[model samples]
Target: MNKHIADTKNNDVIRPTQAEAEAAVKTLLLWLGEDTSREGLIETPKRVAKAYKELFSGYQQSPEEELGTVFEEVAGYKDMVLIKDISFFSHCEHHMVPIIGKAHVGYLPNGSVVGLSKIARVVDMFAHRLQTQESMTAQIAHSIQNILKPLGVAVLIEAEHMCMAMRGIRKQGSTTLTTTFTDAFETDIANQVRFMTMLRSGS
Candidate 1:
């Protein structure tokens, strides 16, 4: 665990115990007029609490630490290294509904390169939290740029928010796209076009 994550205000707040979390679920079930003593519902609260722990495990992780290791012996290969079509699942902070998406991460190495899988793990770390797609996109870009000190970083995410699809308006199949660029990518328009071209052409 990173010291930064350990010292955050979120960690400073006393967290509810598992039993307490299950109790809250039971309360919600009661509010929904469900009979707690019924066999099908008896273990639902416990199961829900367990499920939530896994679903939101991102809060327990540190993206900085995950992207910390870098290989300096990349034979001086300092071009855009992109990992595309990396699937992810997240929950919307507002409605707690699922956000199914694919994240495309790219970075220009500054002499060294981080492990390819590390980039995907960083995406998973953020996706396991309740998020807005826009915020998650920036977080991924900044984490790579700040930790790797890359020449530039670019993140593009295309997601379907279940909050809109399953509830309000109930329109399905609509997707949201978000992007963030930093350093060279932000300052140079040609780099942006190259990135998008590579993405679209699947090169």
Candidate 2:
């Protein structure tokens, strides 16, 4: 990318505030052939704008900060910190439809560990975005690995993409599973096997 273009992209990458969000919603309403000024629709744009802010608030958050608060209390436990079945909802950018699913996350801490809830928050952050499950999986795993610098990191996402089910071919049974792994989870069989088995059993 060109220097100026890269800078522009970085600056524009931040979350849009109410006014911008409202404008986008208004545009959508117009495209749908509705008068946003009508009684019921009058505040609909504003509501949508506010909802988008909350839904995509991940852009305003710092994954590093969320994971930075660590605990030294786990002591000698060498096992992976597994948090399974975290329910999440997001929009697919391709069709801007809801993608709902559960995320199974695990990490092997090396002397330090973060709050268990923060892992879920990290998952929510990226999931709130309009994303492909593949990027969502890798982003969560990479974020955890980068912040915790754990012995290993694994993330799996299983989701129903509404873009496919509600439109296009409209296949009801379609679901996507995406995963990402690092360190021993990536190169070591026993570690990967254990993690996968644990995830399968929903432990």
Candidate 3:
């Protein structure tokens, strides 16, 4: 799990009640000049509260535990295992708007391998939270490196943030790219090039 995320769990904080959360949504609607009493908006707060539970559920997940079960029975296979273009939806921590993206994750196994879906699940555990592309990339890479103890981990994420697309300058299609490399990938330029080559080849 990421350090910032883990800190929140260890810290003393009072979480708001569901009704309070709904009330906050109602306040936002009112601020937007939408009458909560109107038929169209009457149930929106409740619906939003429910939707938020699912959207930000990553706080309740443990990435370490998700990658805990690994298989060491590979037939002497030691090579790069890459999963590319895994789609994810996250909200920017700054503006609370959608940051839609895909992640490319790769790692060199030491002597074992994790289930392929587990890699996707790890991505979700980080994505289903308020994040920045840079921080999220580092978080995913660190979690795999720490838990799986792989020879190296690489995470590349490209995202279009709604905060940029829907507001400010309103550049709708601009994308942000962030990458993190650990262990062997960090030390070896050739490994880094290989990861990027593999990623570009597939695209």
- Which is the leading candidate under TM-score? 1
Cα lDDT over the full model 3: 0.92
Q: What's model 3's lDDT at 20?
A: 77
lDDT of 2 by residue, 1-203 (tens): 11222223247554455576677888989999998888999899888877876887776677887787988888688788899999999888888899999999989999988888999999988887788888889999998998888999988899999888999998987889888989989999898888889988865
Considering summed lDDT, which 10 consecutive residues are worst modelled in model 3?
1-10
Instruction: Give per-residue CA lDDT, model 3, range 47-91, as digits (tens).
Output: 999999899989878997789899999999998999999999999
TM-score of each: 0.95, 0.89, 0.94
Which prediction has more favorable lDDT, 1 or 2? 1
**Model 2 / residue 131 / CA error / Å:** 1.2
> Model 3 clash pairs?
none
Whole-model Cα lDDT per candidate?
Answer: 0.92, 0.85, 0.92
lDDT-wise, the better of 2 and 3 is: 3
Backbone Cα, N, C clashes tallied per candidate: 0, 0, 0
